[model samples]
Target: MATYGDLRWGVHLMKRILFLMSDTGGGHRSAAEAISDALKIRYGEANMQIELVDVFRACHWPLNKMPEFYPWIVNKSARAWGWGYRLANMRPIYSLNKRMIYYGNRQRLHNIIQNHAADVVISVHSVITPPMMYAYQSLSQRPPFITVVTDLVSTPRYWYDPRVDFTFLPTQKAYERGLRRGLEPERMRVVGLPVHPRFSALRERATVRAEHGWDDGLPVVMMVAGMDGMGRLYHTARAIDAQNLNCRLAIITGKNAALKARLEAQTWNQPTDVYGFVRDMADKMTAADMLVTKAGPATISEAFIAGLPVILSDRIPGQEDGNVTHVVENGAGVYAPTPAQVAETVAAWLADDGAQLRQRKANARRLANPSAVWQVADAIWEYAHAAYIPAPKKSSRSARYRILKPEATPQR
Candidate 1:
């Protein structure tokens, strides 16, 4: 038998992990990628085979409306989307919607579960969890089903399903919410959200700034418009440039080609560099003194991991509100919803030898959960060794409270 530290070396057979995510938002895919990287780092690549399966695109048809409508509502009609989100949070509405989704994608769910023969099936999306648990119950013998909630604090009703063997939450708030939702305390572990391990492996800020040809003495403020670059990028950049705070700007206009072109064409008051979709995000983050972006859970978590303080410009309604609160309450950063506010916050932080700024940065680092990736990997490995059988359900249609404990419970 293989020891815990050296499973791959001892076993000839490789274990397969299937990560189920939908493209409704970028966070789920990012989380999947983080776990995949963590597995390779901890267990040799030869030992573990990780496959990221986009559940909605590959399996669930028609029910993929969430991904399709997400960008539309977020970009075109945010208020309407917010109203819809609030409506969805109501128990009857949420339950009805969930059932429709599961029934609509039932066959696809079954196919995904049976076809992959995954040693461990992990879900990072909220909507997919119950269906995944239902599908897992269908199998005569199955691998453990784990749910990793992507949200930091503001989790919705659909995020908690009782069928998962182990639930990994990112914050104490999430764990508390899980308990409120009736998830067993033992099954829920408050392992912070996994960021890409590279964020943890950041080079020194001064070295990175020098490499990027940035002035080492000037404050480096990074403005990110999220992966889609949906926010008011032009206005925010202009606001920061207007400030005479002796600062330089590193603007990450993620995947917004038109915006990138426009920003590059214009002359800036402050020393500025504009980038399209970035691959070396960690290095850029490392070179910065502060981050100005939306209240995306993944972005906030990644910035925390890089020890970069943030100024949240905006957030998706309902889901991302808690992320902003998490940052402000924890003193990791502040909430600045407008261009003027963002600039003011940046200018204020850049002054006084950055004494207050340094404190906030320290707070950000304190909230940093850089070890989350490895912690999650360890949990999965630990669970995989135990005897976990899919509990028999009284009714397939109604998901009851099922305890997913191992037959022989290991003492924590």
Candidate 2:
């Protein structure tokens, strides 16, 4: 048996961890990255190796094209997307879907698993969870598998699997949903969503504003439409600018070149700055007094850590409906479904010297769990250490070796 001190002192070989995810939305990849960063920070990078794989992209034909179609489905028709989400969640439909996935890409998935050879496998995307679990069934030697739910309140049924060693949920509502989905109670934990550690670090607001050359006196409203810019961002920005309110605007058109160019070409009545795909979002959030954006789980989590009040501009119907309710019911934000409504809500929050806005900020702070990433990293470390089995050295011709093996089980 290897003790904690022995493992820490390099008595065992480095552990490899494979993080399974897809770019269907930015949240999944971002969650994987955050967890990877947290693990590296808590345990020295030299002690472990981490690899991120986009399982959907590695699949065949139509399945491999999901990342390309995701933005179109959400932006073109949210109703259609909602219908698909609901339909696929049904037991019959989901079972068929899982079978098709497994049969269609079994060889590719097996090759991926064999090549990676991880000591622990963690999945942050729901689409690949079942397929990956199915792939592990064929392996004689398999690693401990875990799932981390990135959604806040309402999670799809595909996110749960009874075979998973453990499930980490972002909210209590999600934990309850896991129970309803037939996951073991002892194997589930309710830790907040994994956000980048930078979000938790406190930065001086005025200093960040100064660095960005933003006005120190005027209230700044940071508007965003997610990483792909898949929302009615142009119309909302115009409506807010048309308000002629006593505030400044900072619009981030993430990866939307045309939108950024159009916004820059037009004249505004207020002090406005337009940017495209900014890397320093934490700094931008720190300089802003409030946030006006779509209901992305990662963005909401980051805003909470920054203690910034939010005005939700849009959401995917079935996937993000619970997020809107969670924010509004907790008094951290308001649901403004239209451009005009978003503008009106912003104006109201900016009234009376921002008394209402200050309260919302307080509520956001109260809801924040800045240490969530560390908590999740600690749990992963514990499980990974427990599951690790060091490789044995080759025996000489004159010598014989006896290796003891445990009985194989279907589930952990």
Best model per lDDT: 2
Candidate lDDT scores, in order, read 0.81, 0.84
Clash pairs, candidate 1, are: none
The runs of at least 3 residues in candidate 2 whose Cα sits more than 4 Å from the true structure, single-residue gaps closed, are 1-11, 388-412
Clashes of each: 0, 0
Residue-wise lDDT of candidate 1 within 170-228, one digit each (tens)?
99999999999999999989889998989878888778888898955788899997778
Model 1: ten consecutive residues of lowest lDDT: 1-10
Looking at model 2, the pairs that clash are none
Candidate 2 lDDT for residue 205: 86
**Candidate 2: tens digits of C-alpha lDDT, residues 1-412:** 2211212325555666789999998999888888889999889898887888889988999889999999988999899999999899899999899879988998888767756656688999887899888777545435678899998887998899887789999888999999999999999998889898787786888899999889558899999998888799999999999899989999999999999999999999988999999878888999999999899988998898898889999999899999998899999999998999999999999998899999999999887878888888888887776643333243352122122223331122
